[model samples]
Target: MTTATRTLQLKAAPLIVEAEKEKKPVKVRITAYTGGIMTVPGWGPVIIDLQGLDLPQRVTLLLDHEGRTEATIGWGIPKTDGKTLVIDGTVTEATDAGKLVIALLKDDVPLQASVGVETNQYRPLKPGDTITVNGQTITVESDTFLIEGGILREVSVVPLGADKQTMVTLAAGVRNMTHQPAPPENSSPGETIEAKYILDLLSVCGDDMSTFRQAIENRLPLETAKALAETRRRPVIPPVLNAEVKDTPASILAAAALKLLGKESLAEKELGAETLSAAASYKPRTALDLCGMACQMSLGYAPRGTNEIIRAAFSTTDLPVALGVAANKIALDAYQQAPATWKSFARIVSAKDFKEHTGIRLTGDFKLEELAAHGEIRHANVGEETITYKVTTYAKMLMLDRQHIINDDIAILDQIPTIFGRAAARKVADLVYTVLLSNPGGFFSAAHSNLITGAESGLSVASLAEAIAALRKQTDADGLPLDLVPRVLLVPPELEATARQVLNSVELYRSGGDQLPAGNPFAGLNIALEVEPRLSNTYFPGNSTAAWYLLCGPADGSFLVAFLNGQQGPTIEPVDPGADKLGTGWRCYIDIGAAAADWRCAVKASGA
Candidate 1:
């Protein structure tokens, strides 16, 4: 409010006076401001003392607030009528911008007025404070500064104004409005919009000076100029491309490896049909050829020698990642092909991190209690038992030397990574079987009534029935029968045929001197047979070919194989090869753990 000067723009409707149709100069009357309390943006509430308002005999009327010579519409004599400041003016200019005001007046359209003032003397007032100005009692509802003394510099005709109650009037039928020369034929109605108005609009839309100059030169309408400015203001967006350009170099290399292995069909299936078609182009390349491509793509030059190519490729980021991804794909394929007997009898779960994962078993109170009539059922606190385990990182490194690349052996890439994958799978299987064979916490014991040993406890129809019955008769933490069923028959590789025969045969028979056939009760039971070679391997501390187990489905929470973050297979990572090293190296690793979860769901036979 204390700024050097401030302009308060107010809207006014032109009042049509008595007709002067033959007059050469059209005259009009306007109430610039119905002086009272007005809210000015930034300045807040402002009260103008009408008596202190200074007026000139011939105040220039400018278009908007440009103040240029061409913007002068005409001059007007301003006077006060106790409360409102009125202006009597004439339409005396012929400029295109001024003509818009003349046209509005000639057609009896309303006009707006804005008065610029210089604040010379003022008094600030607090809320609810009363002050006397020009014999009128004014009580401010908010903090405001009263303009006790000010000079009315000039007035302007704007398309829109801040205040909406003032009025402007044109004499009726004063048809010959323009008193000056006509505009050129090239001029347009868009010219009526002031350049400053257009500039302000462009500035709001974040347009440069070039765009503003274009709008002025072309004399574009307000809406059209706004649209152009908006279009240029938007952020630029990039276009989308197909897989050949979109896919990473690593993924492309993996697809190419599949192509080299003469398994192009699998490559399409492994990576969607559209995935490898563009990158591999149905062609295969050796390890050496791949290194050369990587060098050319990354270093922008063809490889010189096999040794340099291998060194340079290993040095670059994309080449190592590409090689790692290719190796991982091959390793994963082999890992899947390798047998994992644990999957059939144990549940597979994921660990989030190295932190120990607690498996909570809810029991006892889970059974619903009876409810009384018109009474709510009470909540029960179920019994909980937890087992904790954490995943461990297992890894090994493989080095691919210059000679290996020089020989251009694709088989090395295929066989080495495959071995790593199988090894990783074997590691997981070993962990799971170790926990089972260790019989941690007596998982299979006489106290639990799940372990059986006798002459008839060997692999036979009667032994399977007894094991299944024992598993089904097992109790919960509260001594309630779990009602479990045998879903899998686990045995050593040596007993695979016998175990299968026990479940698949239509009739069972004695293996001793007696060959008489007995009834096969397990023939119709859909029990899966899983044979693990490690169960009988001497590498383990307790290896037994004659020992076998009957287990419940994985959902019964008998045992679980947990992989970190659900990454079931191993991952291959490239190692940085420094100056001393002559070859590239990759470390393949897996995060995994295993443990026996519950004892009630499994029954073991000694087969003595």
Candidate 2:
């Protein structure tokens, strides 16, 4: 602890503090405690015992712990002149020299800890290497890791730059990546709904400077950021309910419902099938246009007429995310959030719970029956050894399905023929149930997200990881993920030799002048990552499967909701009670994908 000092050139009250290390960093004020002395014993390496020291010859005051001259004031002032003057000082410098070490403080009881250096001293000789450590926690990016005596868990590593690495991991409640989930035997998907309410007005919520100030601060709540907004008539803009001009997820989802009813498409075509920037959530396509394709390819379920389910699109909100009308108007355009462009569309089907939408939603821990569902782990190495499947890495795996949709009928799926059979289906369902419900070793809970498991369709850890890595950044390293944003991140598999160039060079953010300037309004580009692991559960780090999204729009921009799917990976089994098969496949693409959407998009194309 260090304090600034002022050259006492006043001829009034005497300022004194007891000579002690604890009484450091004092403020020189001639207030009520003018003649009072503050004493502190010692701090860090320094100890003070104010014994004999020079003092002013006039009626000066004294302050010392051990009577040694810790500091002096009023050296040559006239005797007792009751005058008041304010003295301040210049700022101080920063250095590691005065820094205090931090640690995981234990609440139960304090432990006997010495310098950690001596404990790890017995390691293979190396200089500057972390020789020894105990009870240590480190955060790199969006992941948190703990080390005890030198072991890592909950945190993994991946290469980023040639010389550096990106500390990435999945968030909670996401059984697999691609942000999809399945429904179970009884329940069904909610009806294709419309935004019964629209957020079109703006009003002042309140004027609490503290709360308002907190909101306007960087990366805080947009509605209440008082300082961030113009301090004119009102500092705060109410949400859709009040003056909230931004679009709400609920409202957008509702708009998609209307599209199913034979109205004009929510997403109007700028050119054609390309998802338009003016679309809701910044997606290029509508849910209805894509859900049918997803059902046909992934679950083998054809929509009777129009499948009614909650349509969703996932993307990132870069600054000025074409709030169509707002972007049209240069002034408001600045407020539009430009979401990353990898928007995937899908519909959550509630009616097809038992048939096309079939998945096991494991509500509890892994039980014996769950294991039996898998039959034998390869050579029946179950309890004896760890029969680890893709346990959730979010590691990008190359996609065999070309058009950005999961397909079970891919040629690569046929190779692992074992992974596409009946027992495997049960295992897959159980895994989906577990993936939907379990965390492997994370804080996500499937129940919190209301996941629906099903038969006709499912997600492969490989695909999910690839998509996740491509879209998000592990910004927060805290265990609870407070600062975590539902951005995207992805990686390609080692085998994607053909597509590696495009996946790496174009999809990734590079310095081709596409590099975003520091503090760009929109979140930087995050999409179509390099594929790596081939399964969803096995690839995402910490087996994290949870994500989040915040949908925003300009005052004038509006959107229609639609459904789409990015996965239809090969089938492992079918357990559809509604269908004649033992288990149905996942349909509706990923109506129930990750707990959080993690992306945004403007509605792209729409049709009646």
Candidate 3:
């Protein structure tokens, strides 16, 4: 649980699936904290993503020693030994499930008189072995007897060539393991035992930073605890997988950062992730902050926090005396033993407690008081204060050996703006699509939001008013899409009159006087806003609106979200960063009612 005051090196490094063949720490890759520290087994060829390093390059770290081995672990992928479980007599009639039915005459296991026969992964049946079920140990009876959910289902076996590592998925969901009065005399310790991937590493690391440190720092291969100096480490458990990552835009990422650091005021006092997201779609950094505040949010759903901000105040220092549950791997990335949830793991990290649990010890010069306080510049404590964070993240397209670094394509980014709203979406859409419309290389979210940027000359904040005034000239243009396009960016509620002028239009005889073709199904429609605070690219928790099929085609104009305070509250408000909130934000998503219905007239005439 405790980190080292000296060097925070890789501990009990687990060999990435194919790590053995590759030599040296140079091959080590940095995957993100799957909620906790990981074992760096040794060396291999790999891609490394470090702090400030978006594109992965080659980097290496020399491992002190591999982990010490424990007792003969269980589930050591055992094989059939070229033998099979045999039923001598004859096959009986097939059961409804198509299983062969057999009547037991003489049984190998004296405990039970009969046995069931079925075709499993490999061999048919074996002999001379005891088949146990729910504490009932029995040998193979003459041939086979009908049985279901018995030994085959209860006991896990290895295939002919498997090396005894338990399947991560199978190990994650197991509980109250099928026990016997006495386990088979021949089964290996780990074979009958459930493999707790994430926790298993923690258990080996234990609660003490020094001991855990030595265990990992030593880089001892999977040896016994007796061989190496103890690294007492209490594990900071990983979070359980409960949320899924869906489509989010890149603007959402940028916008969140702006809102959080800007510290915008809002109506709600609670100020959680949901409300913040709905209130300001343009600010994403704030949403990322919200995600870390709640234990429930996870990378599978929104993988934007930690990397986006500095989180020194929240690191764990406490120790854990006992484990509540085992760790499971839900993500396909990283090792197969990641935990589904590690909130409990974090709560215990504030104090020095790992020594008693894990055999590792916390060596070096640091103390608890010094580590928990603010950042400092003391030469003596520098080594202890620094953290060696290891991450192993994977993305579809990685840029390497290129003229310049990869750029974020704003278009693809829009699809994943986990914390954006209608206005932000429109802006991002325009930016992304516009870039696509202009660039020959095409559009990508990474290139747009992070990569592509406008020069300072593009437009200054002071000149924004002039731009709005100039835009007004086109508000009532003869053949433009709108007499005046909505000038939502940088314009606040104080500019409502200006907004109204643009939306309603300065002129009446405009070419296009409709929302979008007639009967747009969603015409006159309204929507409900799901607000969040501090979480990035996250949706409102379980508050999804009912799904309704749209009647209008692709060109149909539709309304997504319209802000409202409440039943008796105002829908829109002027920007007032000085106040906690100007008014409550609400929404109404609608479809174009009539193609020829003057949109400006309808909006201007409405009470809103």
What does candidate 3 score in Cα RMSD to the true structure? 29.7
Candidate 3 regions with alpha-carbon error over 4 angstroms = 1-77, 82-465, 468-488, 493-498, 505-608
- The C-alpha RMSD of each candidate to the native structure, in angstroms, is 27.5, 34.6, 29.7
Cα lDDT tens digits for candidate 1, 109-161: 65666665544445667877876654456677777757666566566676555
Badly placed stretches (over 4 Å) of model 1 are 1-245, 281-284, 303-308, 509-518
Residue 294 displacement (Å), model 3? 28
lDDT of 3: 0.20
Candidate 1's displacement at residue 423, Å, is 0.7
Off by over 4 Å in 2: 1-493, 498-593, 596-608
- Which has the greatest lDDT? 1
